[model samples]
Target: MTLAFTCKKCDTRNIYKISRVAYYQGIVICTCSGCQSRHLIADNKGLLDFPEFGRNIEDYMESQGESVQRLVLSNTGVSTQDSSTRLSPDDSGNES
Candidate 1:
């Protein structure tokens, strides 16, 4: 699924292609290609509770106009450094 949101650091519009599996995970970390700043995307009740997450993001994107940067989420995990690096469920950055 595709997600669109504005970067808080750079104010640049970003579009991310997220995997459906990510919804099951605890947290999702998104990096803005424009400023290389990282943004955390998460749902307190968990993404499973909100099936419309993708749709909501799409709506926000449409309302914001054009998106300048695009990123794709890998099946294994979100790559913060290299392709070999994968963030497991334990590394979701959530202590809870």
Candidate 2:
């Protein structure tokens, strides 16, 4: 999975790529490539560390005055804008 967000401190755009395992872990810590600031990206979990910012990529970018663009890409070179395709760790790779 790839995430593109802007740093609040440096205003630099950061692109982060992670594996499916990391994505399903539900917590991602991205380091700003420009200012080297550590940011915590998680879902529903409150602040726990001393990161410069603690929020999902969307919220963080919104706070930084950047519009959120959500896109999902699959291995078959297919892309979609469906947010309901969210995957969980327990997903069995089968459609019900």
Candidate 3:
């Protein structure tokens, strides 16, 4: 099975080839192919959720060490920047 999610940094669609059981783990890490940014998805006490961009997901994972398994997914295609979800330090940061 494959899990799909948008990259928070570049808004690219990241697809991971993982089993259903792995998808429901306490935490899941995915590296974006477009911008190479690390994303952290966690289970907030039974609430499965994916954190947004600029949340320092990688920092948290690094702290976890081997306790967490990093799942690096591949991109099925090229990424066209999504204006609605681009991570820009500037105001709006919408790329035209």
- lDDT by candidate, in order shown: 0.60, 0.67, 0.51
lDDT of 2 at 32: 94
Q: What stretches of model 2 exceed 4 Å from their correct place?
A: 43-55, 59-67, 74-96
Tens digits of per-residue lDDT, candidate 2, 22-95, equal: 55446678899999998777543554653434446566667778676677656533334765555543465777
For 8-69, candidate 3 gives per-residue lDDT tens digits of 57889988765455445445567888998976654433443434322233344566562323
Task: Tell me how candidate 1 scores on lDDT.
Answer: 0.60
Candidate 1, residue 92: CA error in Å?
41
Q: Model 1: per-residue lDDT, tens digit, 1-29?
A: 67677787888999887776663444566
Quality of model 3 by C-alpha lDDT:
0.51
Total clashing pairs for each candidate: 0, 0, 0
TM-score of each: 0.41, 0.52, 0.38
C-alpha lDDT of residue 74 in model 3? 30
Give the 10-residue window scoring lowest on summed lDDT in candidate 2: 43-52
